[model samples]
Target chain A: MKTLYIILAVFFLILSAIFSYLPLGTIALIPISFAFLFSYLVFKKSETPNNKFSKILLILTIVCLIFVLVKVFFIKNELEIDTKFEQQKIENNKDAKKDLEDLENDLE
Target chain B: MKKTLLILVLFFLVTSFKSDTENPVKSGESLVYSGSYNMSGLLTQIAQVNMTTEKVTTAKNNYLHFSCSLATYSKWDSFFKIRDVYESYVNPISLKPSLYKRNINEGGFIKKEKYVIKGSKVNSTVSFKNNQETQNSFTIGTNTVDVITFLYQMRTVNFANFKVGQTKSFTIVFDEKEMDISLKYMGKETINAGNLGKKECYKVSIAAKTAALKGKDKNIIWLTADEHKIPALIQFSIPVGVGNLTLKSATGI
Candidate 1:
């Protein structure tokens, strides 16, 4: 189990480092931090499970995750807004208004 | 406890020998649905879908050819025109698709895909309007069916055998990946089916999320409550409102 934990930790660590250079790179921090917590808990039976190197890696991962969360919540992108749906709503309202007018004219 | 376990095992063994049901897709028949896409209850666009099956002779053998086409009413063509056609050549007995083709023209972005299945393998080819072509191959089970074929298969199924609240799931390997479908039977209801008027229908909810359009919403389908099991209405949630395709007329009885 200890070896398996080490393998998973190393795999996720490499994957996180690689993906951190791509688009939405900050998302990679999630897996890295999750892997750190999981590996530490599972391998805590070992004498040096909380070694300085592992502790520092876990801290860095958490810091990166915090930074990403803050940036995503605070930053806004105008282009990401769904303007197409808004346009459709406006068009549908116009059609409804026309239909109502035709109904009123028929009643008159 | 041991005696009861033995009896349970014996019961399962006996039930495991049940016979398979026959395929229910009839040749030379078709289904048509016509409805409008309303934005927040305001009618904005209209859509019509037609699916038909016929006997055709392919190069290698004779097969039942199924064709389904979806077209937006010409009035709404200026807004968002969609002309999609799906064709599948299926085994007359097994009802498995031997060859399938899809031609889609949505919002002027055109794409074409073809699948040729032989025994346990399928070869897929896709081409875009921009002249990019990709070819791939995949292994599939003998009972594999494409999306269009799956719809017709659903129509032919004996829903009465399944209890209400029962969910049927199928995984289809297409477009290079497996897509999971979960269809739940939601009891009987009477719905106004456009020109068809009010009819007894079996309500089924397809829990496929409409994430691309807007908030997560399930696609609801109402099948005519008879052996034919025709679809009365299909409602989809979009970014703004619900889009429905209701059955208006019928043919090929």
Candidate 2:
């Protein structure tokens, strides 16, 4: 039924929008494709065959697809060096070295 | 019950007399991995893991330092940042750990733990986010090792002699607790290791004696069947979904 297709389209559209904004990267494309499929089905089953809801769903699907594609290609997953963590590492190493010396003396 | 007791005794006896295997990993060896999580059948990288080894010399002794660090990528840092480092200082030839340190900062929670292993006893110090500290000492099995050392020790194991379905067990001190973990050999398989091409690797499934690691035979690791024996792939079951680590680069083998 056209109503069922519209409902599925809306559901998938929401999921695609949410996933696109999250750090899940290109995974949003899955929901976007499903939204597009359901939106096409809704349009085909509609009596007028030019329903505004179907058009809106299709547009949203394209927006989400484009957003995810831009994120996948442009966003680089790089690690930012933490200076505080580096300092903590140095301190831990220093303390460990001293402890090792004391331990060796105790063993001897 | 009597059979179980006898089997346990025999297992202990066998493990006690086993000598150290030849060292396959050397100092300055570094391996970088991309830790990803499976979401909707798509793998999304979450963290960058780096495992490195270094030779450290003190006034009295020389030790091998095995350091493993995990840090979330820039994008994930905003949502749930994790900067964790686990290190083990061990004897170069025997791989017997002397000191183990873990400093983890996940989200906003922070904790630090250190253990000094001497003979058959371990001295532990744990500090929490509130600056509360606890120190304890306990006795352990002679062959008990820390997590980082246990990971490096796996490379020294001779998998060629192991039969399929054979399990090798180890007692590892993690989070100030002694855990019995076993690795079941699942035979050799060639997997496509990124940047290293196709490598023949020994597939082994890991089982832990704790509820933290759920599912049977779901956690598996693949190690390169070579002198270096670097870990090529690791797959484990997580609460949300399955997580895996793929070897991105290896150097100084």
Candidate 3:
């Protein structure tokens, strides 16, 4: 039973790694959380030879979760800040200014 | 036979003159405009605006319910597709909006705004798609109209009496902000349109004083030189291109 739990934990950690690379959004967090659950149970209250493996898996899953959270939440809306204040900065952009100039000329 | 022919000519002329007295804002009247945005001669059909005004009698007041829907064409749908519907109820006697509602979805962002006005104060609430909500208040005057109702109110003004370069100013409350909009009359001009070709129209440029609208937003509207005062053509200078919305058709007015 202990080996089974370790295998399951390793399987979920692998999925978390692949999904993180694929950028699956909040879905990637699910496997990572499950990996943590399985790793803790496999190593619970035991100092077996496999306990070291469980500890390593647990650390890996935690790191992957942090990465997924940062990618999904923080990196997704980088362009939003530009759009929110883009109206005031329209003149500073060369392409936008040129387009606007052409627009005014077209109106006349 | 000559007498009969003369009577027929008189009847035809009388009915032709009757079209000149068309009341644009009467119940069930509708106007549709289709246009495209041109960027450095590259044209793309980006917008279509439809407006319908109806006169209704409620238990308390006689109101004009105006509905305006604006949408982007399929070509521009890939970047940011907008489907917005704005409806406003105005007391025609006082020209003030009693209620206004907007359902807008641009790109993936969704927002719904509801404003209930009581005399000089307004209670407004906005519900967004991300489970976020906001409430606001505004002190408006009796002359303050919503954006949709403002179009109808502008038609009621007497433009012919104003001389060249004359300007008219009005305050309109839009999206939680009171905008001071000035329309400068640029004299009468003749322009060609897809449907109403070679028609003479009154030219007016928009100068709005509000943070909600940026200074880069420039617009010019041409109203028909008729008694009903229908908008003939509207051109806007946007960041991408100059959008031209020409009146295509009207009915029931």
In terms of DockQ, which candidate is strongest? 2
Per-residue alpha-carbon lDDT of model 2 for B1-253, expressed as tens digits? 9999999999999977765455797999999999998876777889999999999899989999999999999889988999999999999999999999999999989999989889888999999898989999998899999989988998888887789999899999888778999989999999977678899999999999886676999899999988788999999886668889999998888
Residue-by-residue lDDT tens digits, candidate 2, A3-102: 8888999999999999898888766778888999998898788788667877888888999999988988898889997998889888988898988898
What's each prediction's clash count? 0, 0, 0
User: Tens digit of lDDT per residue, candidate 1, span A7-59?
Assistant: 67666666655434332324455566766775565457457645765565556
CA-lDDT, candidates in order = 0.66, 0.89, 0.70
lDDT of 3 by residue, B81-161 (tens): 767778777766656777787778788788888777777788788899988788888798777778887777777666767
Q: Where is model 3 chain B poorest over a 10-residue stretch in terms of lDDT?
A: B17-26
Task: Sort all candidates by TM-score, best to worst.
Answer: 2, 3, 1
Candidate 3, residue A39: Cα displacement in angstroms equals: 61
Evaluate model 1: give its TM-score.
0.60
Clashing pairs in 1: none
RMSD (Å) of each candidate, 1 decimal: 19.8, 7.9, 19.3
Q: Rank the models by DockQ, top first.
A: 2, 3, 1
DockQ score of each predicted structure, in the order shown: 0.01, 0.62, 0.01
